[model samples]
Target: MGSTEEERPEGLLGWCLVANVARETLHGDSGLDLQHGTKHFSADALLWIPPIPWDPGHWRWPAVGRHRGNSRRYINMVVRAEDLENFRVKGVYSEALVRSLNGHRHDPAAPRTLQNPWSREQAQSWADRWNQPREPVRIDGRSHPLLSVPNPPPAELRVNGETLHLAHYGTRGAHYSRNPPPTEQP
Candidate 1:
């Protein structure tokens, strides 16, 4: 049996909400199992959780959260290497801003932040709301869900004879030379 590119199961790419304290302790399996595993879904376009450190000025940086005391932070579930192929450039989100969300009590009806070992509902809501196109918001002065479903950053890799170059989002890049090191003249 064989499968075509389109036929292959669209790789699952989504985030799971985990507690800040348990951020480093939790594994993909445990993260997936949170919220009764209801938030888990077949992600088609993008998988990275935003507020990446590459841009500290962005709102999501440091992880956004509702205002409340003794509140536990939320960290996105880590995506596995095998799943990298599913992402644009194997784009992996940062775990830096562990507790980086705007802790504002703007709306009294807004959902409250959860503490360590978050409850199933907290996990579910976070996962469900992530990158929801319908829910409009601005980040880094840009409208989010950027059309309801954010598209993966554009990535390209090319080789020119003796050099290899790879770039993504024009924000970062990598280059390498194929030539061997010069020999020492003794």
Candidate 2:
């Protein structure tokens, strides 16, 4: 199957949230399972997740909540402009029918608490300002434009006994392994 008009990101940048599925499934018969619905893009097409500051006191956008009592980590990756597909700005963090399971905690009295910080308009403007199509940076005299989230969670996290590194498709920061610091971890 091919991507529909709604599945296209148009133009956006930030992180891509990829489900932990078999490579074949992601590229073959079964496509991506997004918050909106199941949608198919190119094998390289990414599901854009806007970069909001990590609030230690508030719920994180892509919280690594538990699954069967173990930490459930999704593949948070960065991509060059050419690799992007479409953006799912609304309910981007919801899992299936569950709304914003990975977003801000619900508070009915304060309905804004449940909303994502960036609106679609804001995201588009951000993309325009920060994600303009630029030539790849040359590193060590070679083009290495890929850059991952600075200070990502440890690559040592285990999922089903397999070492699961949440960040991919880019270079890790100098403080990558030392982060979440000590205070950030619950």
Candidate 3:
């Protein structure tokens, strides 16, 4: 027997719909003036709606510019099945708002060119790394060892009079701190 809706894996169609609803709701009343781009449901939530895909079929070549057209872009938003249901119940969106999304489901007979690159685990790992807080490099003269000196001093060093902190010095890139380093002793 086919899996029930609860057991069936959530499809990309659902995420795309939720994202559209979120963008419209936020843009209309939130006063945040968010541009037409990816929108996160919450600061702590891993879910987000990616930017709307560009339909190359409608645009001329040079007008397309830097955005290379691809079918994969259509299904890039990853979301949990339960989250979609919860958002619906919480009045984050209405069923009527996304009713048309049902019409856009991919046909089974068509070749599957738009596979999701990330599994749930992979998406969680990426979100964890992206959201991990870095310890700000000490520049307040509290006598902590400097993580590493910036190779080429960061622009903030000159503009804001601050020092850069390398979270994983000699490995990862620099992150800036507003506090300046302690003045050199004679």
Task: List TM-scores for all candidates, in order.
Answer: 0.19, 0.29, 0.24
Candidate 3 ranges beyond 4 A from true positions: 1-114, 134-186
Q: Can you write out model 3's per-residue Cα lDDT over 73-185, one digit (the tens) per residue?
A: 22233332212211210111223222322224434453332222233444344335433332323333332233333454343433244444422232223444455445699
Worst 10 residues of 2 by lDDT: 18-27
Q: Which scores better on lDDT, 1 or 2? A: 2
Judge candidate 2 at residue 84 and give its lDDT.
42
Best by TM-score: 2
User: Model 2: per-residue lDDT, tens digit, 60-130?
Assistant: 23322223222233333332233343333343433321223324454556432323445556666655544
- Winner by TM-score between candidate 3 and candidate 1: 3
* lDDT, residue 111, model 2: 35
lDDT of 3: 0.30
Model 1 lDDT tens row, 23-94: 121125423432211122222313333323244342222323222231244433333322222112121132
- List the candidate 2 regions with Cα displacement exceeding 4 Å: 1-51, 55-83, 86-98, 101-113, 129-131, 142-186
